[model samples]
Target: MKTYLIATLAMAASAVAQPQKAETPSPEPSRPQMRAEQPAAPKPSRGAFDAMLYVSVQDPSMEWWFNVPEGFAPHISEIKKIFHNQEFSLFPFADNAKVKEGKFSISYSISMKSPDGSLTELVRGAKYEGTKVADDIMVACPDVIDFKLDGRFPEGLYKFFISAKDGISGEISEYENHIRLAEWSAPVPFTGKKLVSDYVRAFSLQPSPEALYSIVFSDDFDLEQKGAPNSLNYTYLGFMKAAFKKNMFLISHIRDSFKSLSDLNRAKFILILAILGEKGIDASALSEPEKRYQEQIRAFKLPDPYGKWDPFLGAAQIDMLWGEFFADGTYRPVRRILNILSHAKEAAFADELAEKSRAPKTQAEWDRYMLGRLYKAALKTVAINARKYPLVEQYCAWALLHGDIPEVSYEVLSPMLEHIREMKSPSGGESGENPKVRMPRIDVESL
Candidate 1:
């Protein structure tokens, strides 16, 4: 029980975030040549709709900020805005008719002033106008904007002043809007006592903001003199999407900061974070479908009445019959997939998916445990497979033992674990003998 758990969780998560972090963005290039680059881009015929990734991306002029697509920006009124929710990821889309053609410049300036001081020129004169294309409806691909705090932008109200001038029309649209940038998330050390991973899991996997405050109630721990969770210290989960990395980082920090923990709680706590870190929810690292699926999950609700959303993307692979979630997150799909995998002994798909889903990469010491977590995707299926595949059961049991939340673990798994036991013969398994699967004993030392 050496406290490598914190480091292991961080390492696993950082391993995924490292690539994006490695190329820490410097100033964006000024030219916006953006010309030759587009001609070579894959040509997909679709209406011109502007898309942008709103994460922590930087252009030459700005620190950590968002970028508008190079061309065909619709009128200020033309932008389609999706209001923030518990999911907090907003996709701003513009009509192709508003796409800017010819040479034009979009200048963005950001400034903030508080009672204590006046802040100006945090980023100014950041101009983007490139990729000359027709003004018609043939634009493909969504423009991306990365909105984030690189720890520089201060909290409080600030104006994001945007001015667009047509190089040909000699007409300009000027508008300025205020945005509140809160302090980005960071892990907090336990000021007094350590809480188990249950607190961490509850906070991170909160279905709604209303559910989180109690997880870290002041009555439970010393949260400064204020003795309560406050905006100054912690952010709402609604902001978790854009700041997901920061959120997880903060959670890991909490996990690592434990002043004390029982052996059992520590083991369970590490497993919860390790699995999530290994299986990231990074939008940058997901397919379009994956991005949508995750969106629904983050919101804890998927409105798929029209059948427009899918909850399983890469994990389902070619055969979605075994996928994990429905748009509404019912476990029917989980059950269906498990039944198929458990019965489809002629095919290797189930095992393959289980193996592939297990820590994409991990030290050998914890690989089996990771695999157990992975098999949790089809927990019921895992239970069935466990009778004949002891290793599969071991992994599944380990995964189901420590859920993303306590309720999830106990409510869903407690019965399942008991059912699994009931399926076995009194001696051990179905045939009064333990299945002799040759998987190595779980070596958690590396974990």
Candidate 2:
């Protein structure tokens, strides 16, 4: 019995010592290996943003910056009329928080959609690229973006849309606004339509002829058809500022070497003569003083006796050429051409222009006499005297549009032209019926 018990125990021990194979995990139902990553939550979608923005129809290459109205209502209605082929600037007020990244790009599109479902793309998906948040909050619009739009849209209610895309996050935010071009303010009156058509033909150029004179000389029809191009059409002041934009290409390239003021005496005189020839303004029609002056200039007509003038303008100007068209800046050339008739030209005006050119930001200190010289020179060929109220009014209208002088100064002249009187004071003053203007007491019948 003891032997049998020992064997039985050994057998039990053997049985206990024998190891069992591991059981395999049984496959229940076929299941996904990844627990289908809860399809990432859709990115946040912020509704359209209308940031504080300002538009400038200047050259496209200019440093187009951003501005948000300071806590007050924006005076967008005060914005003036715009034109075609104009460099339209669009800026979005961006801050550090919303941008989230240093680099981003904004896609811009402009279109005119009619109520009848006519979809016309004025600007389609043009990208303003390589943008970054600027250090100065005021000028946050990056230089990389093409802020200019080559104004081509016809008269219509057009929508302009801008979208910002975050490079890092792939998130997008968008903004939109609308603009309407009532009309490109043309030169006033019966003469302007014909002049504009003539300009379209005469100034017709593929890449724009090298210079104004070159265009005049190159095409036979251009010269033949462009009668009084300067006198009638403004050779140096086209609607697109084409006339006065001589060295503007340098500015377009963001180059610092732009000679705004140069010896345009030869150019000015030649252009004037060419246009005067077209006007059929008899050189004999000049007064005794002007006739004598023309005789003396007739000797040296080829090389015009142009004097010092600053054709030099920076960034922009009135009507793009109004200030220039006024010929106030053409002190030396206009004076030399007009001579005795140039009693209209004065010394004080030249000094003011020199100072202004030196310090462009500071406004010139000009007296009423100097003001007369500024406007009178432009009328050397046109204005026989101040009694020509229609001529005077025409000049006033041009000044209002182009801003030859400071807007503040025009305040003084506005009344004088309105009441058909002379400017008697520099700063504004009261009179019985009409306010006296800051002007010199001269015979309007004579220069």
Candidate 3:
């Protein structure tokens, strides 16, 4: 139940105001370079209209190649293999051009030739106006063009021909480049003793948190047997610590395992899955696992520990609902929160709070208002149930730290933090006199 609340908040802020550096691909000597480095064909002596096209694997990184000298020779040493879901950008720079009255026009066309010798036009006759930067310098109005290699495109080596026409001088410049489109490579499958040994080896190497997250959430990762629960021990401590540092790529592969688990086992995994889901992890690639999780929760017949309500179940549901609201800005999830509140007084207070809430006028306002309400409701749930279920205290700490609401003052959260600290025994024994609970863990070695 330990959350990356502080790290998550920091990441959220940095993501909004920063541009991410492009991912550098590993060296591959076998890849072919683009033919654009060759000399251009002789042009007619009438008027010179020259342009150069530069490619970047990431859109944000295009700025690095934007301001080359007029006679700079462009060379693509190697084109990295791109995943089907990834996107690359093309930037057209006008080296020499003719302009009239500080105005010029440029149009572009892009064609892809597949390995089978069939050609497909990805872009055709896209026009943009150009501005004269100086007496003889002209630049494209919108210099960047993005191409996404989604599912529609097949995996193969593709020959790309990019042509740009100078409308004023009736001259065209073309560049030939090659790129390979591919699918995300799956990890090699491992089970039983191999799984545990490999996982431990990977931990010892100190692989990046992002790399560890990918391995754990990959489709190839699985436990030894279905429905057999385990407990968190020293083995998973490193992985969980690394995973908590990441706030994105929160995908989980535990749905298949959860489907056949016992009531309490399912509930335990669901809570962990829900916490991860709040960070944008996909429960399933295409299916609605949210609906399935909810259905299982409704069928739970276990002893309720938090008075009339099951705090563990409620925590999972609330987390999932909050995640959904953040993703799609849907009001249905907010309405569902009222139904989940066991206390009429708390529900009534939430209802009144929603009723008195003013309509948001902008996107930022909308985010602030909606997120504020959801966190308030989450805080109320924690306050009512944290003392009853020690796990609830973890959830409470997660909410207070990760909510990022400006209205929540330190004076309000300081006491809660102190209370949580007091709940923990110095010797790391059972928290708050509560009996030690065997939380559900994945049994990788058994598989």
Candidate 4:
């Protein structure tokens, strides 16, 4: 029994020492796995913008003679009395929100819809790139839009639209306005007397230079009439000033228009030429006008004795011609000036004028007296032949004696004097005497 129990225990130990087979996990229904959630990305910012419109008008209070009212409250819904061939201006503004780095851009398009439902693109995709914000705000606009109502557009209501875009933030703004063109009317026929009266009235009303210009150059207006020359003298100076301030190009057209006038209207045309020279129009452009003036004055045949012609008119003519001569270095204008002086001297009016100059009653008389004094001064000065002296040098000598030099002429004279001083003599000397020394020196105070 002891041996059987030992064998049974050994059998049990051998069974325990032997390795047992591992049990495998059974697959019951396969399950899917879950992933961790991620946060969302941010959105881009949108900018703000607004639109504005302005009607540009001529206001002395503003620079460049134009006033563009700011803000949207004063926008015009209907433009009135838009006459044919009359120009008008509109300013479209883009009030944009400031962007990063103050960097922004603007693009605009303008269109006009006519009464017939036809659209005319006045401005297409006008773009201003790299525009910076001013005063922490970006109020951008393209150039002023100017248009005239002509035969192309019949008198009717027209719609104007402006589309502006901000390139930086992709913002767009739009604006619309309307204008009613007036019916076309024929200009009234004006006689010389009526024309002069109307022109004088226009000055007080402060009508645009364009309106006054139309009246002055009207087809029905007479260029030759009683007091016509004097009337121009009294009013044209003011007209020219206004026109020059408003538009410099108009002055050129006005000067050239003299070419169209009839030579029979001698006195009036002469006055026009004089006014142009005084107003500082380019002398080169006036060459043809000056020629016409010379021809007309010669045909005028001044009465043999100086007194035969109206003294006021004659003196006025001389005064006007003097202005031309002073402005022009050419010989033609000065030739006429000398001719009139010689005639008055021959007629012995100089002494009488000197006496009357002391006590002048009218503006015309005062002008005549001044001419007399100028003539007397010319008489006392030594004569310089045009052939002998260079044109600029002759003018310089005259200006020195007159005690005043016009800025325009001085610009040319100053450089010339310097060049003369630097010039080497024909003998190759280091120093040379100024040619001006040959001309007689007159004390302007004595004159």
- Model 4, residue 255: C-alpha shift (Å): 18
Q: For residues 1-447, write the lDDT of model 3, one tens digit per residue.
A: 322101001111111111111132111112234446666555435336655554443222222122121222222222345555444555444435566675566777766687788876655676766454332343432434455544556788867676888778788887666767775543433445555445533332233323344444433333233322222221232233324323222223334445544454344445445433333224453236555765554453422212233332444346444433222222333334433322433434445557988465776554444445544555575455445433233433433333321222323443665744322222332222211222222222221
TM-score of each: 0.28, 0.28, 0.34, 0.35
Candidate 1: regions farther than 4 A off: 1-117, 130-155, 181-246, 256-268, 276-447
Q: Whose TM-score is greatest here?
A: 4
Error of 1 at 217 (Å): 13
Clashes in predicted model 4? 0
Q: Which residue ranges in model 2 land beyond 4 Å of their true spot?
A: 1-54, 64-80, 83-117, 122-154, 167-172, 183-447
lDDT of 4 by residue, 1-447 (tens): 011100001111111111111122111111111112433212223335655444333321111111111111211221334555454556565554345564556677877787788877665776754434331243425345555454455787677778877776677777666666665333433456666545534332233334545555554434333554534442233333333343333444445655555443333435444534444334354467665665554454322212333444554444333322222223333434443333343234446755666565777666566556555433332133222334424433333323233333333333443433322222332222211211122222221
- Give Cα distance to truth, residue 291, candidate 4, Å: 19
Candidate order, lDDT descending? 3, 4, 2, 1
- Writing each residue's lDDT as its tens digit, candidate 2 over 220-265 gives 2121224332223332332223333422321222112112222232
* RMSD to true structure for each model, in Å: 22.4, 30.2, 19.8, 35.3
Consecutive 10-residue window with the lowest summed lDDT within model 2: 1-10
Model 3 TM-score is 0.34
Each prediction's whole-model lDDT (CA) = 0.29, 0.31, 0.42, 0.41
**Model 2 collision count:** 11
Ranking by TM-score: 4, 3, 1, 2
